[model samples]
Target: MPTTPAQPPVFTQKKLPLLRTEELMLNMGPQHPSTHGVLKVVLELEGERIMKATPVMGFLHRGVEKLAEDGTYHQFIPHTDRLDYVCAMYNNFAYVRAVEKLLDLKVPERSEYLRTIVAEVQRIIGHLFWLGTQALDIGAMTVFFYTFREREFLLDWFDQLCGARLTTSWYRIGGVERDVSQDLIGQLRYFMKEFPPKIDEYNVLLEKNRIWIARTKGIAIISAEDALSFGLSGPTLRGSGVEYDLRKAEPYGAYDQVEWSVPIGVNGDTYDRYWIRIEELKESSKIITQCLDKLPEGPIMADVPQIVAPTKDRVFTNLESMIMQFKFFSVGFPMPKGEIYCGTEAHKGELGFYIVSNGEGKPYRLKIRAPSFIHMGAFDHMSRGYMIADVVTIFGTYDIVMGECDR
Candidate 1:
C-alpha cells in the first residue's frame, strides 16, 4: 500500500504527467536500539504516518536446529538456553518436554513439582524483564533499574540452584539434575512475598501515568479473531480476550495441580498487552507461592538409571555402576521413533518445539515456533495509520524480541 514519488506511479496520467506525489522510504533498524535486538523494519512513509512496515530478519540466526542434530541429547540443552536467552528456563523446559514425550518417560513427582516452581519463578522474572525493558523503550528509565534490581535476586537464586546463572541447563530429559535445598526454598518464599511490593512499585511508576496511558491506550490493536487466526498464544492471545493458556489447556509439569487464572484484555490494544503481562506477573507469583508450600520430599530424578546418571556413591564404589554410567554417556537411550510438538507460554507468546527422533540419541529434526516471529508478522497491520512516534509505542507494547524472531 506504500507509494513513493521516486518510483513511477502505478497508474500513469495521460495529460497531467508532470504532477507527482511525495512519499519516502525509510529503514528503521537492523542496528537500532529500540528494536530490542537486530531487527530491521523497512518503512514506506507518507510523511509522519507509516504506509507499510516490512520486517526483515535473520541477523541473529545461530542455526540452532542444525546445531541440535550434531550434539548429544544432553549437550543440546545448553543450546536451547541461547534461543530466548532472557527466559532460557522455559526454553529448556519446552525442548526437554518434547524429547521426553518422544521417549515416553515420566519424571518423578518431586522433580515435576520442582520444575514447576523453577519455571514459574522464571516466568515471573521473564515478565519482569519485559516490563522493565518495555517501559525503558517507552522512555520510563526508572522502571528498568527497579526491575533489574529485583531480577538480580532471582538470578542469584538461579546461581544458587545451578552453578550457571543465565544458561542453567538444569533440566534433564527425564527429570531435573538435582534437588534444591530447604534454604533455597526459604529464600524463594521470601522473594515471592517481597516481589508483589516491587510490582506495586512498578505500577505506581507508570500504570496510571497520563503519558503512559496516552501513549498506549488504543495503539496497536489486534482483534480477537485475527489474533486467533494468526496462531497467537500466551499473552498476545490473552490480550485479545482469549483465555487459552498452555498451562491450563495442556497441563504439563504439575501445572494441573496448581490453581491460576488466565488474565485477558478486552480491547487487545497496546495498553491491554502491557496490562496482561503485569497481571500475569501477579498470577505467576501466586503459582510460585503455592509450589513453594507444596514442595515434596522424594528422589529428584526418576529411577531410570539407563537414561539418568546413577548415585554418586554407586558410581564411585561399584564396577557395575561405572559400566552403566559409561553406557548412559556413550550410547544414549533409544527414544521412540516419533514426533511431538510441545508448547509453553513464554514471555512473548506461544513458544513451541517440534521434535522428530529416529530411535537415536540425537533428534532427527528440531523446529522452534517463536511467538515473536508471528507477532512481528502483523506489524504492518498494527502500525498503519499510527504516527511515527506511536510506532515506537506500538513496537514496545508488543514486546517483540529479535532473538526469538530471528531464531
Candidate 2:
C-alpha cells in the first residue's frame, strides 16, 4: 500500500492562460476635424467606452478679455465679432446691450424692433449652421448640403443689411448701425415663407433615419438639475426641460411685445437637443415676422449727442458734430464708476458680459460668460460610458465654437 502511493501531479504556472487588461489613452484633438475647433480632449477608454474625458482649452485664446481693457466702449464692439464668428451679429447685440445698460441709456422703440428682428434672423442662421454640421458629423451627408443651402440665403440677407456677412459689426451701444431698407424687409418676408418647408425637408432627412436615432436618442443626457448646476442656457438648458429663456424671463429689444413659446425637451439627450434647435428655428422665424409687422417709424439711434455718434450728414456738414464724432471714436463716452453685468439670449446660450468701470472710456475689467466654455465643463459628465464614436456627436450637440470657448 505504501509503494502504491504515487507522487502528486505537479502544478505549473506556465500551463495556466493569462488575461491581459489595460486602459487606453487617446487624444481626440487639437486638430481633429470632429472636434469643431482647436480643442483637445484627453480620454481614458475601457474597451472603446469613455471612462474619463478632460478638455484642454486655450489653443485659440487671444486674450479677448484683456483686449477689451485696451479699447474704448465703442471701439470694443468689433472685438466681440470674433468671439462667436458664426453669429457675429448676436455677439454685437449682447456686447452693446451690456455697454448701454452700464450707461443707463435708452434705445428708441423702432431700434428695439429692428434689434429683435435681426437677432432672430441670426438665430435661424446659427441653428442652420448647427444642424448641417451636426448631421455631417453623424454621417448624414445629404442634410449638411440641404441645411447650408438655406443658410446661404440668410447670409446673403446679412450682407445686404450690414455689408458684411460673417463679422457684421452692425450693433451700436445706443442703437443699431443703420436702418433696414424696404428691399431688405421684402427679402426677409420671402425667407420666412420659404424656410419652413426647408426645415420640414431637414426633418424628413434626419428624423426618420435609423442611424441618427440610434446615435443620438439616448446619448449625452444630463438632468435638468444637473444642467442648471453646470450653468447651461438657451437650447442646451431648454433641452433638459428647463423653461428659462432670458428673452421671456427678462424681456429686452421688443421680445416682450412679441409672442412666441420656448421649446423644451423631455429627455436631455443629443437628439432632444437637436429637436430643441429645430423648434427654436421655427420660433425665431415667428419672432422676426411679428417684429417686422410691428416695426415702427421713428429714430433708429438715440438722440443722446453726448453718447451716440452724429449722423453721417451731420458729421460731413456740421463742425461740432464732426468734433463729437471724432472724440467719440478716439476716446469713448465715460462710464459710471461702477460695475454691471448684462446677459443676452444668444443662439447657443446666454452670452453675458460683466464690466467694471473706473469712470473711464475703457472698461477697468471685462469678463465674458461664454456658453461654449461653460458647456465644456459638463463634457466629462456627459461623455462617460459612451462609445468613442459618440464623442463627435456630443461636440456637435453643444453647437460649440471655440472662438467663444477659448476667448
Candidate 3:
C-alpha cells in the first residue's frame, strides 16, 4: 500500500518516457564473409531493415595506373592483365585497342579473326567462373565443380596458345605476337561441340531447383529502367530485360560477320540475369564456331617489319632485321593526337578505355571505365529492405571482382 501511494506521488512530480531515438550504424565488412572481396559495406540498420549503406573501397588498390605512367608502352601490357585478372584477355584487348587507335595502326585481317576467337573464348571462361562461384554462393555445390571443369579446359587451351595460363600478353599494338596453330583450332572446335551439353547439366542442377528459386528468383530485383540508369551493363543489364550489347549494337573484332542472338530477360531479377549469362555462353560458342570455320590464311602479323619484331631465324640471319628490332624496341611508335574511347562487351559489362595522346609513345592519360564499379553503386538501393542473407545473393549476381573495382 505504501509503494502504491509513492508511485502516484511520482506521477504528479512529473514522469518521462523511457525510449529514445538513435541511428544504429553497423560495419558489415572489410572482413565479413559475404562481401566476396576485400569490400567493406557500412550499413545502417533499423531493426530488420537497412536504412542506408555505404561501400568502402580501395582496400585492394595497387596503384596500377600510376605504375603504367612510369613504364614504357610495351612494358605496361603485363600490368593490364592484372586489372581485371579474371579475364586478362579483355584487359589486354582494351588497352591495346586504345593504343592502336592512338597510332591509327591497322591489324591484319588474320589477326583480327584470331583476336575474336580468343576474346570470345575468354568470355566463355569468365562467365563460367562467375556461374560456378555464384551458384556456390547460393548453396549449389555440384554445379560449381561442373562449371570449373569446363573452365579448366579453356585454361588449358590458353596454356597451349601462350606459355602462361592467364595474363597472356599475346596482343600487340600492330598485331598478335604469333600465329594460331592448327592444333589450337582443333581443340577449340572440340570445346565448342562439348560445352553446350555441360551447360544443360548445370541448368538441371540449379536453374529450377526449388531452393535456388526461393533464394534468387524474386529477391533483389532490379527493373530495366533502374538498371540502365544505374549504369549496369553485361549480364547485369541484360538480365533486367535490356537488349543492348556492344558486340551487337556496335560490332567490333569480326563481330559484324558472325551471327548470334542477344539474350534478354523478362524481369530484372537474379534468375533472369543467370539465364541471360547462360544463353550468352551458347551464343559465344556460335561465334567461336564461325570464327574457326572462316579463319583466313595470311600473315598473322602485318608486314610492318619495323613495328613488329622479326622471327628468330630472321633476327639471326639478317642484319637489317636486327637493326629494325633495335629501333622498335628502343623507340616505340608515335600515336596521334586526339582521344578515342573503344568499348567491348566484356565479361563484366562495357569495358571501355578513354586514352589521350599528346603525340607521345606513352599515353597522356588513360581512364578505364570498369563496369563492376558502376554495378556496385546499386547495392544500397537494391538491398534496402532485404534480409542479411540476401546480401550474398545480390552481390553474387553483380559479380564484382576487387581487381576491376579497385582498378
List all candidate RMSDs to the true structure: 5.8, 10.5, 9.9
What's the lDDT for all of these models?
A: 0.82, 0.90, 0.81
The residue pairs that clash in candidate 1, if any, are none
Of the two candidates 2 and 3, the one with more favorable lDDT, higher being better, is 2
Model 2, residue 239: displacement in angstroms?
A: 1.0
lDDT tens digits, residue span 1-407, model 2: 01112122222233235656579999999998877789999999877888899999999999999999999988888899999999999999999999899999999999999999999999999999999999999899999899898889989999999999999999998999989999999999999999888899999998879999999887888889999999998888888889999999989999999889988887888878899898999999899999999999999999898889888999999999999998999898878999999999999999999999999999999999999999999999989888899999999998999999999
Off by over 4 Å in 1: 1-20
The clash count of every prediction, one per candidate, is: 0, 0, 0
| Top TM-score hit | 2
The sequence of per-residue lDDT tens digits that candidate 3 reaches over residues 45-155 is 765556787888988888877776655577778988887888998888877777776667788888889999999999999989888988888788888899999999999
Report how far off residue 297 is in candidate 2 (Å): 0.6
In order of lDDT, best first, we have 2, 1, 3
Q: Which candidate number has the best lDDT?
A: 2
Winner of 2 and 3 under TM-score? 2
Please write out the lDDT profile of model 1 over residues 1-407, one tens digit for every residue: 11111111132225456767567888988787788888888888776777888888899988888998877677788888888788888888888887777778899989999999989878887888888887887788999999999899999999999887888998988899778988999999998888898888999998898888878777777788888887877787787788888888888998888888888787877778888888988998888888777878887887877678777799999999988877777776677888888887777778898988887977788899998888887888878777778767766776677777777
